[model samples]
Target: MLLAIDTATQAVTVAVHDGATVVAEHSTSDARRHTELLAPSIRDTLRAAGLRPRDLSAIAVGVGPGPFTGLRVGVVTARTMGLALGVPVHGVCSLDALAHGVMADGERTRFLVATDARRKEVYWAAYDVTDQGVRRSDGPDVARAADLPAHLRGLPTAGRGPLLYPDALPHALPQLDVGAGALATFAMGALRRGEELLEPQPLYLRRPDAVPQSERKPVSTA
Candidate 1:
């Protein structure tokens, strides 16, 4: 069995896959509540699947081009779970899951995966989708929403970025839902082929909002 987790955006998702099928999944979308929601969702999904942590053979996680805090929660949880179970942990690009969620097999399209990066910018990637799967063609770039259209014009798009910048992605397709199942599926396929998956590392594209104050520039009393 494979356990999948994706907290890359407002969406907090968890799933259990028995190699051939996804047994159960759970997800919630509340940007402010990732910490509070993710753990319980994992527990609930496992319960629904009638499985225990020991039943999971491996852990798959979505490493993101997402906000700093929300992305970290999923990666950390996945790593911790893998360590506890002594199982290998795999990381998939969260944007690839979003792209795969929408595109059909055997159909090819130039598509864009855009997720909210906040502060008027987007974390965006472009991919070419086919029966084989989504192949990233460009991007994973962060830019103001207004600039995206010029660079990513005329491609069908998805993710929370469009919700934040409607005009930037006018042809946006719906992809705001559970991504854990896809994350698991992607990982399972790779493992089956003996392909090495990405390390369970957070893929933050930019510096976080909070930065430490410069080493207290020696306060001097003259």
Candidate 2:
């Protein structure tokens, strides 16, 4: 069994993948409650699958180019569980999860994936469906939709960016956000193929929203 979690977008998704297929999953959309929702979702999904943490052969998580707070919650939780349970944890690109979600629906051979990056920008990647799987063709960068190359903006798109900026990403697909079910399925397949997945970490494409306050000079009363 494999456990997968993804919090790379507003959605928090947890799923259990038995050897052949995903057996159970919990998914919800909440921009502010990843920390709150993730743990319970994991517990509930495991219960639904009739499995324990120790029963898992491995763990997989989405390493995101998302906001720092939400992204960190996922990576940290996965690593902590992996440590405590003595199971290997692997990372998948959160965008790739979205791409896989799209491919599964319609098998679009080529397209784009973009998620909200706040600050009027987006975290975007282009993908090509290959014999092995979805291959990231370009991007995984941050920019406004209008500022992207024309080909990218015109590609059939997935994820929240199109919802937020419709005109710029007109060919939007129905699936948005990284689905943990898809994330797990991709990781398991890769492992079966002897492919190396990423280390469990956040793929923050830019600096975080919060930063240290500028140093202030001491006030001398003398």
Candidate 3:
């Protein structure tokens, strides 16, 4: 079994996949409680599927282009479970998983995946879907959506960022939720191909919101 989690957005999702097929899945739009909700949800999903942590062959997590806190919650939880169970932990680009959720086979198309980054800027990337799967053609960067490459204009686009910056992607496809089942499905493919396990890490496209106090410049007293 493969256990997967995606805390890459306001959503906290978990799933159990037996190879390519999902046996169970759970997700919520509880943005503030990822730290609290992740564990119990995982347990519940596994229980619903009648499995245990040790029964999992691997843990898959969304290595995110998302807010620091929620992203860390999922990555850290996956890492802890992987260590405890002595199984490998793998990562999938959160956006790629989102694309996998909607993409169809044999469709030659380019796409831009964007997610809300919460400061009027978005985390964006471009991709090309092929027979092999989705391949990233642009960035995981923080930028104004209007600043996305001109080449991306004609391609179908998806994810929360587009909705957050509709002006930047005026002609793109309507956004859709990228759920836990997609994450698990992508991870299962990786496991089947014997890919190396990845350590969980945040895919921060830019600096964090906070700056150290010491780095703050003193206000002029004149």
Candidate 4:
């Protein structure tokens, strides 16, 4: 069985893929509660699937272009659990998981996936939905919503961006968050094709909002 988890957006999603199909899943949209939500969601999903951590053959996670804290929660949990269970952990770009959901719906046209970057910017990617699967036709880049290329603006779009910047992505689809079930399915296909997956780490496209002080100022008696 494969366990998949994603906390790359406002949504915290987990799934249990029992080789043939996803037998159990859980999802909750709580931007402020990823740390609190992920663990129990994983445990419940596994229990619902009638499996345990030791039963998992592999762990797949969304190493995201997302908020530092939220991404850390999922990636760290995945890596820690993988270590304890003696299983390999694979990382998928959370954007690819969003795009995979679109392609799975039989979308045959090019589209965009843009999630909020929380600094009045977006983590966006362009994909071409193919018979085989979705391929990155353009970006996995970050930019201000209004500053995105005009050509990209006109593509059919997915993710929270449409909700966040309607004027930018006018043709947005209703799919808002990357589902872990889709992430699991994507990994399953990649493993079948003998494709290498990413290391289990956060894929922050930019530096975190918080940084260590370059130097501390001396406190002097005034």
In candidate 2, stretches whose alpha carbon ends up further than 4 angstroms from where it belongs are 219-221
lDDT scores in order: 0.84, 0.92, 0.80, 0.92
Ranking by TM-score: 4, 2, 1, 3
TM-score: model 4 vs. ground truth:
0.97
Model 4 C-alpha lDDT per residue in residues 79-126, reported as the tens digit of each score: 999999999999999999989988877656789999989898999999
Number of clashes in every candidate structure? 1, 0, 0, 0
Query: Which regions in candidate 3 have their CA more than 4 angstroms from the true location?
Result: 104-108, 172-175, 215-222
lDDT of 3 by residue, 70-152 (tens): 89898989888889899878887888788777563335477777778888877777888777787777777778777767777
Per-prediction TM-score to the true structure, in the order listed: 0.93, 0.97, 0.89, 0.97
Residue pairs whose backbone atoms clash in candidate 2? none
Q: Which RMSD values do the candidates have, in order?
A: 1.8, 1.1, 3.2, 1.1
Better of 3 and 4 by TM-score: 4
Question: Alpha carbon lDDT of residue 127, candidate 4?
Answer: 93
Candidate 2 TM-score, C-alpha based? 0.97
- The regions of model 4 sitting more than 4 angstroms off are none
Taking the tens digit of each residue's C-alpha lDDT, what string does model 2 give over 29-118?
998999999999999999999988889889999998898999999999999999999999999999988888898888777899999999
